[model samples]
Target: MDWMMLGIVLVLVFTVGFVFAPLGLGGGMLFVPILHYIAGWPISGELILTCLMLTGVVSWGSGLVHRREGLMDESIVKIALRGAIP
Candidate 1:
């Protein structure tokens, strides 16, 4: 990818993370559509994968910070994890 395109993508990703982190919103939904439709990026497997991974990483990072700050409920997290596991 060109430097400019890479820079734009990075900025957009950071912006999405910044806006959604505190709200505990998943940016994958918005990121894919914005990048593909608004930013004119091609809708492809690679793009989708990258968006998913980025969303996971950002969400995890935010969750970690909140957890460390004692904002998260361990019991709720345990229950959610149990339900999420098949």
Candidate 2:
């Protein structure tokens, strides 16, 4: 990818990260589509894995912040993990 495209992708990623972080979302919904269409990347295992990693990081970061603020519910988190883990 060219420098210009890289710049555009970074800007979009930054925007998505800030917008979704507070909502406890990893922004995968936006990232995958943006990467595929804007970056012209093929949708494949690698792309999906990349998005998974990105989302995971965002989740961890946001979760930590919420936990620090005591805004996280332990029981709800466990329930959500049961469905999400598999």
Candidate 3:
């Protein structure tokens, strides 16, 4: 399972997620450089996986925040999702 690789990835992802979550900054910017240079993960698959992971975590975190604030508008989110759907 490449636990070392996965552990490093999870740590980096979650740390970046926690840090950037509040500032509304996404992890895509950091993920590529880190995966390519720091972790030395392959460019092709790493990019796709990192993006998917970031999207999921960031969206979930934001949704939780909005939910807590009572400002999570389902209609708007649904509309955005629909537009994004292929």
Candidate 4:
């Protein structure tokens, strides 16, 4: 990647990591669509793979933080899954 592109990516990474992270919004929600709409990245299987890669890391880290804060609930999780799965 060129320097400009690299810099934009770093900015996006830190922007998502710093801003949305505190509110428990993972970076991918902001990153992926920006990549798609602004950066003109293709909406394809590759984007899905990229989203998984980035979001998985953010989500795992967020999970750890939430677990430490004792903010996770099993019953609520089950309830959400019950609705989401169908």
Tens-place lDDT digits, model 2, residues 25-59: 78989999989999989999988998888888888
Assess candidate 2 and give its lDDT: 0.90
Candidate with top TM-score is 2
Total backbone clashes of candidate 1, pairs 3 or more residues apart or in separate chains: 0
lDDT of 4 at 13: 69
The alpha-carbon deviation from the true structure for residue 85 of candidate 2, after best TM-score superposition, in angstroms, is 4.2
**TM-scores for candidates 1 onward, in order:** 0.81, 0.85, 0.69, 0.66
What ranking of all candidate models by TM-score puts the best one first? 2, 1, 3, 4
Clashes of each: 0, 0, 0, 0
RMSD of each: 2.0, 1.6, 3.0, 3.1
- Give the per-residue lDDT of model 3 (tens digit) for 1-86: 37898788778877877787766676667877766766676779757786778767886787789779988788888899888889
TM-score computed on alpha carbons, candidate 1: 0.81
**lDDT-superior candidate, 2 or 3:** 2
* Local distance difference test, each candidate: 0.85, 0.90, 0.76, 0.76
Candidate 4 regions with alpha-carbon error over 4 angstroms: 37-40, 74-86
What is the model-wide C-alpha lDDT for candidate 4? 0.76
**Candidate 2 collision pairs:** none
